[model samples]
Target: MMHPLSMPELPSGIARVQFEPERVDYAAPEASGRQGGVQAGWPLWLATFELEKVDRDSADMWRGFIARLRGRQRLFLASDPTRLYPKAAPRGFAGMVRAGGGAFNGSAIAWAQNVDADGNADIGLTGLPEGLALSVGDFIGFKWDATGAAAGTYGRRTMARVVIPGVVSNAGAVTVGIEPPLDMLVVPAGAIAHLDRPACLMRQIPDRSSIGSIGTGGALSGAVLVAGQDLRP
Candidate 1:
């Protein structure tokens, strides 16, 4: 297996970052021509990194990073620039991830999918401070399995975005909606919800990546679209 490459943050950072879920399905044409579809694969993320227009040095730096990627031949770790922390006071729990500080015990103490044991969009996060809530669009990450193996988590870390708004209960638990449900083949267990540094393993789309001077002078504007590598547990 090829090792995944770690990429530096863009020199000029990103002018924009767009995220979308990629769902695959097979069309099941109905007798009356009303189309029905069967899901073909688990959901994954499609991302677009809009490189900011910048000075020659910055443009060159962008070229250097893109060049190292060699256009879709390698994998890199990427995350939503807008989702480094939750949208609330204190914002995150990584710093105080312990018995006294916060709920981040790191042993997957209290984490599981909600409503359905098999797997779904909703997940239950335990060990949070009472009334602590995650807003829609906030991100969380976790991976778990009965055997406590990466094999159950599609062999990699998975990041998910909250889709429904909710608050933690007095018991320090809350259930919220998430998109692109983590691929959990067996019942999920020994799980922990991460509120910091959520990221996706991605491959650049060669055809969609381009960079060069786009306006007057030596300034450059560029963009690249990366797709999450679909994995099955």
Candidate 2:
């Protein structure tokens, strides 16, 4: 099985993502009446995200995140919703985020309710109403709670190994059996967990809008920022 390239979670704010191909076609008179085409360039993938209430903290965080990128930094991007737990190849791509965008946005917030570290413990999670659609050998990202006493000793951020396939159990549980059986720290109750996937380095577009007024206080209300794949020949 082709494993996904381990990558950090996408910054919160992305509400939707899209993939597009950059191609060109031409016909050579001498070659015949048949038409041939070659890839104009690498495929272009775009991710759209929104900035919540637009608070100072959120705004600063977004600004810092982008500023740190310096417009051409390589970053991992995984926006495919269908292949959350890819079983075969084509796990994810490595690209650069196009520059020229100044839209401010934050990351998503999620947490797990309970966890166990037995031979193959089942973990329960919250904020995932649709449950998870995962396969064996997939990876799950976890951020240990800062307040947890063991946070200092154990790695705060780590990936969990998925031992079983299929969606989360009817009780909203997923089974994990860490490979190598290292003395892995148990993810305490209320820790954050997210789906993991391989990522390709991408460049952030420098063109973006300034912080704007907040819209309705609905869950879907926020600003949309776009990032494109940075292709290199």
Candidate 3:
């Protein structure tokens, strides 16, 4: 797992990050009844980041990062550096980088992350974090430690969206419902499960004018960046 403190090699001008919830709603009218509306399942998330005063050196760095990404690569995102999860069980949004570019002057750049773009996987586990309550829309992380008989089936770090919410069963097990089922049949026993609120995928829409300024003297002048989410097969 990559260390959270280790800065991701992204554009240099990123200054702030923001998150938005994604939801779908439907309304219907009956011949003899009032209109009714229904909200879909748990809300997915979107993230946005702001870049400020990107300079020429930063522009080159941004270009290099973008080139490496190839326009839709799945990468882990750490919105908060201080709140990073443990190396053994890192938790964050698994997303793909969207295709975007800055102005000719390289003053600013816009980027976005889509949570549902990658979809989810269904996983069943034998243990539940004691006294922990899970709800729909909560963000969870799954880690398959390289141990146990089923270790080879599970991979490293993966994130998912909770689709069904229920209590721990009498058998001392909790069946987690996630979108997009896990590729393997069984998760390693005692695999790490992380629960966190305020976690989501991010995407930013920057002002085009912010990318038109050229650096003067040795001062940085604008920003550029790209981001995306990993879609499930």
Candidate 4:
């Protein structure tokens, strides 16, 4: 019954990727000891795909995506395996997809009037379609569901990664700057935010050297995969 997975249309021999953010450094003890570590929760997004030259059908499709992530009960929505999109946009995700006709920020409802912890905020856009652009590692997806909702229970999904970068201010505002923050507690302006491919909702830990095939001309390499340890569902 584990038939609820997504995000796995990436295959190209993967050269080198490393999506970041993997916190939980707590270590502020005292009594004559260590005292310099903070970040304590909500920081899980780690990708590290690294497939070298490939062949043999891209090494059997990267070992069939590391055997369908079965070593960890398969869940999906991973990203940044060298970036999924929004790195300059420019008609990429259809340049925000709907403009004069509405629905760019999903029917003009993308919001975020307040947010801080590190995941800065200021996204209140409208139909943007004039050569889109959002920089700094791009990756966005916050929710409380509003326009065209779907993440049941009123959406609790939240993903971030832009480190401060902006544009699109001809009215359809823009002032993003996210990080490891914005996961609810109060992000309700009805809350909504979306940028093409911002992902992170994972479960993986493949092994068996991850992948294989490295001889007889069909060169291949490890198809490593790792997530935030085990954040369970």
Candidate 5:
């Protein structure tokens, strides 16, 4: 079996995707002899995406074939809808995704999807029991299956590590943001900064989950959009 990474050349129409968050100055101007202070706000998250054509034959064996070639891709978000609340995931949040066999072809490559917790995945921003409330020093850390979560199984799949620092903390019906800054797929670098013509349709599920269909808009907020397609050599 030829490894996708080992392939010397990809299909003619295929391309790679890449993206990075736009860097901004966190330091604020100072009234004294020191540098400026940082304004109280969240950093802008940037994600990039690309598209390319893949040989269906070779793609069938590619580790990323499923996510890059499958019918539709999914994205999940846990939020309070108020943009300032400690959000809780619905029952069996990650489990439901696992049951769907999220990626059909990628399983052989160990790209299967799995979450750490069995039921609801909750994020605590503060000890407050009322409306939404998070402290200024609080950080968003993943304690469940988030740690060591990768893409492949049996040494054939890819892995993804997702982490985010808490930029918003307040108590009063707040909504948490779940924008990831990276992708496990091998997309072109240009795809992360622009929007596609189709405008990619977004699907929201009851579990506070969302997914972007392929060839439509699989890339997320931080991801840029490129014209090339995924490749399979």
Candidate 6:
């Protein structure tokens, strides 16, 4: 029998390009619209990516992975909503604004993204650890690893939502485009994006009455997923 680790050959209709949003700074005029007036700053430039439903087998596999990534178990990373805020000292800029929580309005428990060399990608949840609890609108942060590297090398990580924006991916190909066009109504209000630390390992999984160390004694902390799209499919 084939070992469970022996991932099945991906079936047809599976796109492998993973997309994520990057946190960027933005500025706005003061309420009075006058000079020397206080201004509000927030995070913008939320990108997007699509998780093509590959074949029935691939889809099922992806579905399970996504379930775990977005699962209810709390994860601690290098970054969170607090760091996602605007770096500049702009007045009226609040930290950790809650807009519901989790993708699909909290219906799902976990989330994650994975991409291939050909730009093929997938994003979704796997499952939540048993006996874990999470309330709606709770603040979560993610530390994105920014150091790009070759396959198997450690790099930054970020948590973004899967937004199929007019892109199509099948078994062996990937296509990308803007879902909500820039300078348009693509990004929602009060949204921000940021990257996690390198090799962003999800360790120290919390249990019913204690936390367990899975990697480096770190925990898996959930972050506010604003929105994201892949530039390439």
Deviation (Å) of 92 in candidate 3: 14
**Cα lDDT of model 2 overall?**
0.40
In order, candidate lDDTs are: 0.66, 0.40, 0.40, 0.59, 0.24, 0.26
My TM-score estimates for the predictions, one after another, are 0.76, 0.35, 0.40, 0.33, 0.21, 0.23
How are the candidates ranked when ordered by lDDT, highest leading? 1, 4, 2, 3, 6, 5
Candidate 1 — what's its lDDT? 0.66
The numbered model that scores best in TM-score is 1
Native RMSD of candidate 1 (Å): 4.6
Q: For candidate 6, write residues 6-76 as lDDT tens digits.
A: 11232222222222333343454578875442223322223211233244444545444434434424222
In candidate 2, which residue ranges exceed 4 Å CA deviation?
A: 1-11, 24-36, 44-46, 50-59, 73-83, 86-195, 208-224, 231-233
Error of 4 at 54 (Å): 3.4
Error of 6 at 171 (Å): 42
Provide the lowest-lDDT 10-residue window in model 2. 98-107
Of the two candidates 3 and 6, the one with more favorable TM-score, higher being better, is: 3
lDDT by residue (1-233, candidate 1, tens digit) is 44456555532557787877788989899999798778887778888877766676666677777787888777776777777667873345644444334556322247776546644578787666666668998888764332444444433556788998788776667789888677766324544566766666778887876764445665677655555554423
**Candidate 3 TM-score to native:** 0.40
What is candidate 3's CA lDDT for residue 14? Answer: 65
Number of the top-ranking candidate, with lDDT as the measure: 1
lDDT tens digits, residue span 124-217, model 2: 4333323345566555554443343443332233344456554544444444443212123444444445553422224556575233344444
Candidate 5 stretches greater than 4 Å from native = 1-14, 19-27, 31-34, 37-39, 53-233
lDDT pick, better of 1 and 4: 1
Clashes of each: 0, 32, 31, 1, 54, 56
Q: What lDDT does model 6 reach? A: 0.26
